[model samples]
Target: MLLCFMGSIDRFRETVPLAELEREGRVQTSVDGRALALFHHEGEIRVVDNRCPHMGFPLSEGSVEDGVLTCHWHHARFELSCGDTFDPWADDVQTFPVEIRDGSVYVDPHPEPDEPPAEHWMRRLEDGLEQNLRLVVAKSAIGLADAGVSSDAVVERGVRFGSRYRESGWGPGLTILAAMRNVLPDLADDDRKRALYQGLVHVAGDCADAPPRFDQEPFDTEDVSFERLKAWFRENIKVRDADGAERVLRTAIANGADDAHLAEMLVAAATDHRYLNTGHTLDFVNKACEVLDHVGWDHGDAVLPSLIEGMATATRAEERSSWRQPVDLAAMVSETFADLDSLVESGAGTEWSPPASFTETLLSDDPEIVVAALEDAIREGASVEALAREVAFAAGTRVAQFATVNEFSDWNTVHHTFTYANAVHQLARRTGARELYRGVFDAAINVYLDRFLNTPPAPLPRPASSTETDLSVHLDELLDSFDVEGEVDEAGRRAAHYLDCGGDVSLLRERLAESLLREDAGFHTYQALEAGFTQAELRDSPEEVRTLLVAVARYLSAHFPTRREREQTFTIAARLHRGEKIHEEGQ
Candidate 1:
């Protein structure tokens, strides 16, 4: 029996056990420092190279089923006995001779022959890439043709160029062809004709390592056929063939064309279809509106109301069974409203208001209809306040049921926070509601403080020079809202404990300054310092305030500053009493 060992078999035996191969059905072992796959198949022990021929996946770790080993990566299979390729699409792995002698399995220590040339492998890769591209283009073209485009012009154009370009290897040619097909109905006839010619002539010249630009820009388009096609489409077909042309184009577009390009095609089809068939203009408009709605056109006020009125009239004219009537009407109205909202957001058409007629319809006696209308409005970015008021009024008049404030809040959070915040701020400023603003400021401060106190100290906001004064003012307002006495008591306890624990006074002073800087100071300079001091030992407070107050006192003593300034005088006195003295007046 010959032992086929490639690398250090000792290292392989150390990582995996021999018994694991028998019990587990397969075991990956490295022998002679090379990976080896060991498994029992058909009542006989077998071993083979661990690496796959394709992509170098470890075969030993793969599954063994019915004498075949399957590579876990990419599902390439190999025959364990001969190391022959089992998967027709993939290459084969190397086989090694193994035998069991004296109750122990032995492997031959010899490497397999060298792999094929890089050029040979590259040719295969290029072929595979081209084949995949052809499949994709063919499939897409067939789908487009099936969508009622009677003229096979688009597909023929694709095939002609696709075949000619495939010789150079189909990568660049397939991409251009796919792009053309996606935008065929949308592009002007001249552009489509040019694109077809470009695909054919694009990759000419340079058999050996050609520049990519040759593949990108086709030879200067002076070909008479290309020029003739362009001229015919421009002068003759565009004007005369508008109706017949648009029908084919729209069919191509509806049959899985490109999204951004198909929008223009649908629009053109709608316009031409309406003009050509006046009796069916309303039907064409409805279909076009459906497509526009799908594309999320926010039909600002002008287009949406008209579309909704049209849909309403259609619904009334159509009398169908219970099942179809409600579903169709609901779908039409919903789609129209959605398109209207999209149009509004897109800034399309003129700014539109909800028409009185439609608003009355929304407030109709039928609860189901009203509910459906409200849902559509909500889906389209209608304000929460507007929706809620409508619901409330509707419910009061037995038109519809109302929703709760929590529901409105939830809805607003998802859709209307930007509008709501701006509106609230505007109201506060216009009404001069300082108290209301103060309440909001306090709430914001509490939220920030709660987050900071619970979470780790985050990196502080980079201090801004101009904004520092504004921050100080806000800090003061926040401080005024706090219970100073209660905060001071807590600070006193903390200070007493720190002193008892032998903490340095300088460290305490630094901590107090940091706390002051970190505190949410809401639009009031003095209150910011007050809030900081209320939470710190008075003796540990910063000297800037003391210096400022001392200057204020000297000015007051020099000239009696007003009663408004008396508060500043008293504050300075208290600081001085607390052993925080200023060195110089106004210095």
Candidate 2:
């Protein structure tokens, strides 16, 4: 009788006879259903997992020399006494305790684990991130998942890492992670890992070439007035004094300014320059806040100050010729700012609900009318947050209705407006600052300018157009629609059909995520999906949700069928994760 002990107790199971093992030089046996190879190395029996760590090739076929075991498949060498690999990529093989007694060889199939799951994977994650090894990163994600760690945990790790390591502050990688996190709930369990893996890989790429960020010291004073700190922060940002701004911001936090207070200061400064860097500064601030929302504001020391570089040094829209062109849009926005305070006071505490056609009016061809309508809303007692939500939705319509016939780059023109408005809306909701109404107006103007990209707006998927009831079928059709070019409208219709027929929202979200992840998706592609889900939540009517979803589908479809090189890289990662022999020729 033979048995292997597991679960903290050591029990031995029989393998081949010791004489037979020495004669053959190696023996293959299974104990507790785990295949192990016993080798006669240096006149002693050594046992190891039969499968190679590199590619699962049988270790019995490997040769031993000078007490070193080498996997024949990849020629990876390991010290026989332990499982440590000589080659880093090969990874360490798993070894078992072996004993020879009564002319027979036995193994303790279960021994102490090498390391806790978290410890090993976290180390591998750092290795993966530091080395920019996509395969290693993928394996870390898989390993962590197997250990029952939440996807959020992985994402937060990436956030902290990307935020800390990159001297450039927040950029596409963090934004991409934030966007992916925004839609994380919409993804299936497996896809969630894929999404996080994608996020981590991008962060690695972003920080690989970038300099590391060093923390700036806060002002010595621990007790400063909020008004004074706010004023100082805004002033430093205005003059592009990043060091001074970081000091001001850090000092504010040092003085115990709450999250809302910090948001208030950032909001005022972000709008001070009239859409800083095509509204990216505000969006960056918003994303910083957003990421903090996930990872906790206690990370403010690391997270919030990073916004300093972007905000202080960002180019203002007003500085651009486009904002001052034939329309003199810059002058027009300033004029609105002039009247903003008085207008907001007139509607103080009176919540003026926008008309049903409010979004349509915001889409007016005339920037003048768009701003005027916003002023009217403010005078009608519309709160800054409410107006911002309306403006953001209107911006979403620009992307939802974007025409593919235009120069492809135009998608970003509309995309910047949508994400900017979304950011403004999020901040307004948080700070409830009447000052942020400036962003609302700026967004509406952008919407007005972006009108032609939708000159012949892609027709919204006809309402309830499909009678199809099977949810799975809808998801299949929706995903299949992206295989070829020119499936934009088809994708939109399928998404509409899925949502309109009371199909599971989660299912729709899952399919949308799957479709997006499969392609060589761009930054804006991620924005479209996340923004759609976010904007959808803000609307009361189911129809509004449908509109946003269709917009999401249309945008993704319009950009579908990319080279998908990323997917191939992910495939290799997945194969390695399963410990499959990826090296065998045609096997």
Candidate 3:
């Protein structure tokens, strides 16, 4: 039986008769256009949103047992009294304050005064982390930001959970955070939150259900020699003994090892092994240092050890046939190491036209010859910086030049070489350590290793002369032709034309950004865009920037033929956020 509506001006409307709720155990009703379920338990009535948070199922059809309501669809359960969910993916439903007056039940239909949004969302973030709830994680990140929590706080929360939960050390989740963080300042305000959510999704997803590894207490040493500690650190790191490595590092820091020396130690150890962990180990090491930089160095003792653990456990990329075979690239890499000092000394610094020259050697398909040419160029006074710049361009070219392959995953195969080379370029630039030349050599060899992936190479457009037609007008037409091979060939040609007509390098950056922003992009595409911007900043001459941008144009044209699928995901999330129902109860 239904009761006549009555309240303080209809604020708390009578929902259902107490006897009907008690007998039926639960009842469904609508209050001010909102679906709600009323349940009778232990002589008390509880009311909550009737639509399941997971898929918006009608909770009226759900069963109430043992103080929990289980939605039939997907079996998501919520507490009858509090509306808290048993599953993170389902999310907690909203509960309304309930009242009883003379055989009648009433609901306020408005949330009671409670915790602030920031605190609530922060708690939700913790729950999301605990249950590895990706959607919840994203929603909480956005919520926290909207509630005025600092990005640093949000980042610290994730880092704390990631470092604690993933005992084996920094993995792809943390790496994704590190990488995307670089692009954060450049993204639009809304995109910054999206990037943060993207990073948190990975971080939480990574540590979900992972066994926690306890960190060992730092060694209490007062008088350890810096050299000996460094030596011990390298040895332990080599053996993948994280505890021992941490003790050594802690001891060295205790003995007044500044950031520069510590950085040198990391760089030394990173480059000590050839392209350690197929170059990712070194990249992780760099990123870990960067993380320490992001969060105060005070947290170094806690965070840096994870990187050591990651390096010690990582598989050597050189061991793979893809990196080892045909060119005997590893041996060539070793040979370059033997004469690195001489090569650096030999460079008298010359303006060798980049990227064009670098591309020629990469296409030669001979790792030894490429190394020999690099040494010769350095010996002939080609600045190491110049070589580094050209190397980055060549790396981008590898991506831009990639022809269609049967394996879809090959995109990453090619991307790894580019990223590795870019990493080497960045690290070498940062430390200016002479030994990093070996890293440059490793990058070259990997480039050689990827030679076959670019079968049926796309032709690069030539540099344009003054008075060439404005290329911006054809942007859409060129992009439209991107999906079909050889159809978007004009993209490269237009890039050349733009560069030839004395176009500002900023325009290159703008065009690349425009092309990417026009469609949804995956991680690789985002990374590629970052690499292009990084190259533009690192290079001096217009020619270098032009080569990098042209490569970007070619790569985007080839790789991004259609809008990415993430667009639809964001769209659905928006609709649901606005309180719109997405799917029918059962259909």
The lDDT for every candidate, in the order shown, is 0.34, 0.83, 0.70
- Considering lDDT, where higher is better, how would the candidates rank from best to worst? 2, 3, 1
Tens digit of per-residue lDDT, candidate 1, span 1-587: 23335653421122234455567767777666566777877786777777664545567668878888888877888877777765534555666666554455666546445543333333332332334322222222222233333223443333333323332222333333332333334334333333322222222211123322112221233333422332332232235443333333333333333333333232222222111121122222322233233323332111221221122222221233321343444344334434544533543333333345543444343434554454455445444333333322211111011111223222112111111122222223223221222212211111221221212321112222332233333223223323242232233334333333344544443333323222221112212222222222222323222222221111112221123332232233333323343333462
Compute the lDDT of residue 513 as modeled in candidate 3: 60
What range of 10 consecutive residues in model 1 has the weakest lDDT sum?
394-403
Supply candidate 1's per-residue lDDT for 368.
Answer: 49
Arranged by TM-score with the best first, the candidates are 2, 3, 1
Q: Residues 217-305, candidate 3: write the lDDT tens digits.
A: 65687777766777777788777777787777766666677665776677666666676766677667666666666666776666666
If scored against the real structure, what TM-score would every candidate get? Answer: 0.22, 0.92, 0.77
Against the true structure, whose TM-score is highest? 2
User: Lowest-lDDT window of 10 residues in candidate 3?
Assistant: 565-574
Local error of candidate 2 at 160, Å?
1.4
Clash tally, candidates in order: 30, 0, 5
Error of 1 at 196 (Å): 26
